[model samples]
Target: MPPQRPAPSARFTPPSRVRAAAFGLLGTVALVAFGLRIGDVAFVDEYAYISQSYYADLFLTGEWNDPAWLDFPGYDLMPLPKYLIGTALRVSNEPRPGPAAARMWYANTHSTFGTPRTLTSARVPSILVGGLGCLALAAIGAMAFDFRVGIAAGVLLMLNPLYALHAHRAMSEAPCEAFLMASLALALAAWRRSFAGRASGFRILGLLAGAGVAAALAVLAKFNGLLALMTIAAWAGLAWAIPRGAGWGWLWFATGSALAAVTAGLAFMALNPYMTARDPVYRVADPADAGPLRPGPLGAWGRFRLLIDHRRAMSAGQQRIFPHNALKRLPERAKVVAVQGFGRFGPFGPATSDSTIRYDMRQDRGAFAWLPLCLGAMGYAMAYGRMQSRRREPPAAWAVAAWALVSLTVVTLYLPMAWDRYLLPIQAPFSLLAAAAIVGAWDALARLAGWKPRLEPS
Candidate 1:
């Protein structure tokens, strides 16, 4: 009889040093999340959070009843982050009254840097959420690929100064990315379970529901999180295409998709009462009346329309101010995005601005050029592997490739300016790929050098 193969546990496992390295990396990510470059400078957009959060607290939680609550949040397509900003400012308020409530004070006019109390109120949530996002990214890397890959991705993202810059701001990008990564991690887990042949009805549905809910929250945070739709669609598509038991494939997929949609839809409607409004309601700032709000009844469709109209209006205003920003060349935009993907910007050609984040166009950059090198190595490995194996890799491999490359391409096609922060979503997935590439290159070099890898001996 043929010798029985060793059990799975007896085969391969990471060494203690790898575990130690991962923990160390995680510790470093946690440490840097709070202070590095945080409160460096006051951004022009920071003032909106002051007034918006004030109105949010007065309307969302306080007994104060006014139609202005609907209008105070923001003009952007999304509304959930207002609640987070509101809660942060409330914490600042409880610690004794001060200039934290002065709405116009933070408009990049009075101060060059963020003040103590206001910075805490406005940016703490983002800092914590962004730190947690690094954790989720690690999990995504592990689930989608391996533990080493996850750890590397997390470290790379943590080291990315651009991510650090925006993460410390009261912007929608960080939270949106966190939720989007969470959804991807959940979907990956579900895929692994199904691949292992243990996909029970309850297990699959629970995972799908969780993923869907995360996606909904992501979109609520930022329309950029709408990328979650691709993930959800991929799962639903897989359900229909990938074979289940003999004759139940169609029914199983249909049930899961419908159930997940229903559950997530309910959660979304609950989280964003903006969807429940009967007509279109939007906020307009009035310096004379200190930003009075006017809201109309709005339904779900109206909310979506609000997003489109607001984006269009923003585009028009931006074009007037930065006329050269609307570069119509796809190749030029793509080149700019690719460069920013690795945490470098300025186009700095020298880091300046007192090492503080003053302008989105120019700041700390050219730091992670090595990342793209790793990406190139990783791409070579992937291509070589594909050539050697006739079979395709998992669905995630294709999805991630599209996410990193295609998504960047799409974003660039419409990108109005060379803003580095807007590249966060694209950089996120690309970071994962680049981390894998780095590991692959190191292994390749080690092999070439005749260095043996550590293995558990029986």
Candidate 2:
């Protein structure tokens, strides 16, 4: 018996018109999804992100109108979005100085029953960035699988209850993952073009450069943005190990990682002055209690280690405070992953428990639950099957499987508690796979009816 060579996936590529229609529909969904949620203030974490971005600006510029502005309660994550979100709020005329900003935060969150202009402005960046994420996911689906999968996945992501409620908040989820998705999308497209001999060496190198920059920006957006690099690196490492018909060597994947590392290092220093800015001896609270704490500029390597340390401290604190939320055991972790990723009830409020589940369903639950997950399973099965077969398959198809699996496994294993938004790492890939399932069914129905749209190859 001879080994079976897998069929190339370029045959599945939809024509220009179908591709355009898919993108157009996805764009509309992404925009509408973002527009509806830009005004939301239901999530409490929103308070910190806007305030931190505000404080980051003040600290960097040395523009302290009030002494209180020096108390820049820094973010536990990366530094890029501080500038991005701050710039947005500033352009929208967010209240400046320490007290007014504090008052605004307090008014909108704790005491006041009214929505503020600043809250909406603070969230605009998230909404815009999240919208980009939706479109990017759709692109990943179309390029990796089919237009049906791509469109369905994008719509599901845009409208998912957990994604809608948190992904567009003035926080870390959307900005980081969107850029990561872009990097993966670029990698998929480049891999296909290179395999087909449609791209020159220079063009291929350019694509790699773009993917690297996007990956770098993703990391700067958030630390977990490493998922993008990790996915590419994994596929690169595995691609060589697997017996295949034809594809680029794993060295290109190595180049991507190197490029991302270099770009992140350069961009970190360039975009965030805080990396080199001096920190004055400032006490956390009362000047009398404890001593003044000081640290030098968090240079390239230091920042990543510092982030890890901060997260470790956070985990320790969480264990003590939120005793019931720890995922120390396998079953415990599995249950949380299922709830946060597939099920409805999840960690909300200032705490990581659903007891504070005043989070309204009509406002938040915009996506289907069991159906998408089931479809994603079927879709992912097909992708994995293609990769396993001896025949040629799109790198993006295999890469999506790798991305989702790695991310989901990491989340399942490493996530300290059951926070819904932590599922951001795995959501994009899953959504695309779910779309694949739907597309499979649609195509079957079209074939049966003898009126399937003519899907010519590119």
Candidate 3:
């Protein structure tokens, strides 16, 4: 070695390592913020918690087959959240009053509701899941783009008022977001591994299977779980189509995807027996009770059929809240999406204003709204520019853009009612996109200023 090449700066730290540290700190801050007042009494949507009590009581009594439990509104629509609550209650040996001769006696008798006196058991899972969502966002960003992008995305997500507020609440959205992001990240990672020349069959299978399980858990958390499958499919489709010629890799990926689907089905049925099992032994409601109840010695498929019908009815009923014409509704929907994405602009912003004065005042002025908006637009533009210039775009960008576009389109078309909470699925992708923008903009600025970048582009 040339003696003049004196010890190339051993003290210089890798940019990736620096970014990882920043991300870890951001995640920690998010965890603490989410955990704050987790067990505090919920003022709004208390009914959701109360509804969970019914399912928990049934599970505690070993009476999951009871059709009577199906009487609750939206019961057939989603059952995974409550099933999870039951598991948590049983494992912790919380004070469940069900299975006692009188149902709802202990719950109604005590103001705190049945099972755990503190709301900790009910709320902790959501808080933990919310924290996991933040990390998953980072992983997706890092794996798809770079470590710096991941860290920036995570910090932005934590700073989001709507996301942060809902994270600690005993609600399904937080957990849904967590499962959704985890599934997407795992699926993307699996595909990347498979594309590598040295990828092992076992490794690919494991990644695919893990993704399937996460997908199932996501669905259990909320009906929107199905969207994860769609996102992964779009990613795979884009990957295959963008390349010049079909390769053996496509066949392998498709086979793995089929296996993942089967695994997802098994996981879904295992966690939620009511969707498949015909065991009338646990009489959730009397079989004789009339109305739309279908008579049965039902098949495994019967529950799903009933669920479909119920969802259809619910959807039709919800149309009253939205404009009859989709065209007329598009502007309002777009406004909501923009406000939610970039954040509220000023004091008493329309998007941030709410019934709760304190909450409204705090959220009306969003944190670094313009910066994220500017960076995100630039990032996407750069991505497209690269593709146009004959550079193979990063697969992660395609995956994230597809997720955001598909999710936005579906919600705008099918979801008649407009509520901010309904848009939770977009949070991760939005944060990631913004982070991409920031990083992309920084690189452009560096190039313009003729400064050397420490970390080369991945």
Clash pairs, model 3 backbone = 66-282, 66-283, 66-284, 67-283, 67-284, 67-285, 68-284, 68-285, 375-437
Cα RMSD, each candidate: 5.7, 5.4, 6.7
**Per-residue lDDT of model 1, residues 1-458, tens digit only:** 32223222211237769766776669466547655656566665655554455445544664233444354343443656666776777766633222233333434334322346666567777787778778888877665555677787887777665666667787777788888888777766665454333346567668768877987888778777767656556565654564333334334444565665676677776676555543333446455433234345565666558666777677667767666555456776666565554435321223222313322344335534544564674575355334322232233444455456545655786776656556667767777877767676676798899995664422
The 10 consecutive residues of candidate 1 with the worst lDDT sum are: 3-12
Q: List candidate 2 stretches off by more than 4 Å.
A: 1-18, 55-72, 75-77, 97-115, 197-199, 245-248, 279-292, 297-299, 345-395, 448-452
Query: What ranking of all candidate models by lDDT puts the best one first?
Result: 2, 3, 1
Model 2 TM-score (2 dp):
0.80
Highest lDDT model number = 2
Of the two candidates 2 and 3, the one with more favorable lDDT, higher being better, is 2
What's the TM-score of every candidate structure? 0.77, 0.80, 0.78
> What C-alpha lDDT do the candidate models reach, one value each?
0.59, 0.62, 0.61
Find the number of clashing residue pairs for candidate 3. Answer: 9
Question: For residues 1-458, what per-residue lDDT tens digits would candidate 2 score against the true structure?
Answer: 33234454433666679778778877777777677866654567666566556555664576543233223234354556666667776787665334344445544544221247766766777777777888888887777766667777888777666666655677777788888888878777665554432235455556767777888778777777888777866766655565544434444545655665576567655554445554465335554322123234445467456656767787878767777666567777766566445545211212122623323343224224553555466566556546534345445566666777888788888777655666667666776766666676677797899976665443
Pitting candidate 1 against candidate 3, the one with the higher TM-score is 3
lDDT tens digits, residues 169-192, model 3? 766778788888898888888766
Off by over 4 Å in 1: 1-12, 15-28, 55-65, 72-74, 92-115, 235-264, 277-295, 339-396, 454-458
**Model 2 pairs in collision:** 5-391, 6-390, 6-391, 6-392, 149-435
Model 1 gets an lDDT of 0.59
**Candidate 1 lDDT for residue 235:** 60
